[model samples]
Target: MKEFLGTLGQTTARAYGEDLIDFSRWFEESDGIELVAGLVTTLDLRDYLSHMLTVRGLKPSTINRRLAAIRAWLQWAKRKGAINDLPVFPRHLSEPKRAPKSLDRVEEARFLRSVAREGNVRDNAAIGLMLYAGLRVSEAVSTKPSDIEIGERKGKVIVRNGKGMKRREVPINADGRGMIGPWLAKANSDYLFPGSVGGHLSPRTIQELIKKYAYQAQLDPNSVTPHVLRHTFATKILRSGVDIVTVAALLGHSRIDTTAIYTQPSWRDLERAVDGREGGNGE
Candidate 1:
């Protein structure tokens, strides 16, 4: 598996490595099942999927990803004559149709106020990038001083470690400038958000800090995550008449189909649409 993964890109390799490691651990612990590919059957794969869904409580997307990774490994092993009989891959579970989580205007205002009051320079800057620039947490943390170009009038965030290793520059708006400016002035390390011990801030640390800020803002901590901030950024801009292509570019999405998910109307939006059409005194 490692050898097969080695031929892939860094991001893909790392994800497959983690997925294989998890599968190995589960295989070791599961009763009456050895880790050998030849010994595993289609039923065993189904059981593994069941374990992921029931025991691990993984979401459909995550479960599908794990299954895909394992299937790839099994296919490679079979082709290499390592395993004569390969188990059938488990069918992917259908993802539920649900609207993406995003902050409403009121919640966004409250969140901004909370950050101003309770957050430090780095906290403000990190939130700014994800909320305004549509950056992933990993992209924000891995950003270096050289990756940013902030001027008085305009600025851009040079995303180096974006998803799928795709690099892009995201323009920063007025709000982003205000938040990142103070942080940049005080930064002494190579990274934008330096860690206490050494490298850039870990994603887990950022998650915890966001949770703290959410509590301070009187918002639901579970709903306010870095990705939710990104969603909020995209949804707000899209609502304000930004073209989907531009939004997709800013968000570093390779496919417009992926970005189209944000086009789904919120319940509040649907309510407004219906309210606008209601008869009003017969004009």
Candidate 2:
């Protein structure tokens, strides 16, 4: 197990290790099995899946993740000659498809107002990059003052190390420029949003900051994250009739299908459509 985990990155190894521990404990306690890779049968995996879904009431995604960890470990054990034939793993549980969450116009206004009321220039600008420029939290934190270029009528933020270390340039509109200008003027640190330890702020810190203002705005803090803010930006841009290719570029999505999620109707949108049709019928 240690050898298998050593092949993974530290964070991934830690998570996969925890998953394996859980699986091992359940194997001993529930099934009286020793959890040897060679002796574990397909029935054991099926039982584990049932236990996770019915007894633990785990989400499909969580169950799938745990199962994935187990699968990887077993594969490694097989390659090392611990097992001659691999047990057939059960199929993953089906996860429901849902549109990416984003704030509506009213919620966005309230959230921005709360930020304006309580947040400093740094907070506003950091949030703006995600909410207006559609930067991922990592991309936003890694951004330097020199990466931004604001002209009289136009501006862009250069994401040097985006997801997969791919670079992209995102144009900044008036809203983004308004929030960023003040911070850039007063910027001193090498990073735009410096951390206490002298590096850029961690993604968790940025997430917590968004949650703080989300609570202040009287919105569900769980629903309003940095990714949701990025989704909001994408939704807004796409709704304005911008092409999908353009939106994909702005969001640094390699695939247009990834950007197409913004086009999916939200629950609110579906409700409004239904309400409008009912009103028309009544009229």
Candidate 3:
């Protein structure tokens, strides 16, 4: 299965294929069914969900994506007549109730400084995009040299296969573009951050790099993941008074509501509200 996924040659496929294999192993271990017979029913789907939730203790979002991959695989198998019955599916919840994690300006600075000392161009660029551009780690690593247009005044990054497979182009200012100089110069291959085998960087390796830098910066490495870098970018921009709509588009979010979740109220916001309440006017 991994070999088949390797043919796809995209990071997203790699993750999905592994998830499918994991699901099959989980089902076999839990239900004693080495062979998933034809025509899976809704019951089987529900049972799998129950196991993931109760036994594995997976969070709602992770569990949902894994189940989705399983369901899609089953549907394809059924079409191929690999299974007689369709696997049963479980009811999906509306959303995960967890808040997204972000870093403050001080922590963000420390993280970037730590990575600068790592002395790996690809690693710095891959992590920098998350901190500056609010890119998902996958999006940053998969970024192609072609997708970036660094300019004197403004720059842009094209992100393919973002959340829900959406594509969006985001503007980068001088600071953000400056961070990529070494990465672009050192990047000889197509991908901005090529893996040991070429193509996109390994997601696992990037996670490890994040952990290492977090420790050096004297921060909680457990809390300092790639997503935290992305969150820091979004929160910093929003608090700096960038409009929510523009932030949403830059983050490749499909909905403004999703972007709204990242918005942080700045000190100025509180001061403004209080000033208005007290009827303060220009002296």
Candidate 4:
């Protein structure tokens, strides 16, 4: 199992390993059964799900995540011939829909101002990719200097290491190009954002940089992560009347459903809609 997991990306491998350990402990301690991949059955997994929901009080979303990890590991084991048959996953429990968190326009302006005040050229460039191009932190750090093409009006950024090891090109709006220009001029390394050890900056380092500026800017510190910036990009672009399919393409999302989550209107938008209707009727 350990050797198989070693083939995955570092973050994914760590998470899958943790999920496996949790299931193994539950299989032995709760089921009092020897946990072997081939010998496990659908009934056993069903029981495990029941235990997680009833005793462990795990939410449907969490259980779904665990099931995904376990399923991937089991499939790998089966391919290696370590397991004869894969255990069937229980029917997934439905999770409530929650809108992705993103900063409103007012908050976004304040955040950018804070970044300009507290951050360097590199920081601004990094934030620009997330804010405009919807690049994930991992993808942003993995970007090479050669990946960007910033023209006066339009440009594109190539995400070298996107999710699932895929690559895609995203357009960099004028604002993004302007934000990235200074760093691109002075960039010394092959990487867009070089790390101390001579490669791209670590995701944690990028995250910490954003967190620092977020605090100085007086925004909600908790909401200043790289992912929130991504959500902001997606949400803002979608609200700007871009089609969901186009938004998904820009975000490098494999499925349109993932991008549809951004369509949920915010309270401000709902209020505006209501006010517009009432004003039109001269009420």
Best by lDDT: 2
C-alpha lDDT (0 to 100) for residue 167 of candidate 4: 84
lDDT of each: 0.88, 0.91, 0.76, 0.86
Q: Pick the candidate with the highest TM-score.
A: 2
Off by over 4 Å in 3: 1-99, 264-283
A best-first ranking of the candidates according to their TM-score comes to 2, 1, 4, 3
Sequence-dependent TM-score of model 3:
0.59
The digit string of per-residue lDDT tens for model 2 on 66-110 reads: 999999999999899999877898997888666699999999999
Candidate 2 vs candidate 4: the lDDT winner is 2
Candidate 3 local Cα displacement, residue 74, angstroms: 31
Which runs in model 2 stand beyond 4 Å of their true positions? 1-96, 280-283
Of the two candidates 1 and 2, the one with more favorable lDDT, higher being better, is 2
lDDT score for residue 266 of model 2: 83
lDDT of 3 by residue, 209-267 (tens): 99999999999999999888888788878878999988888888878888877654545
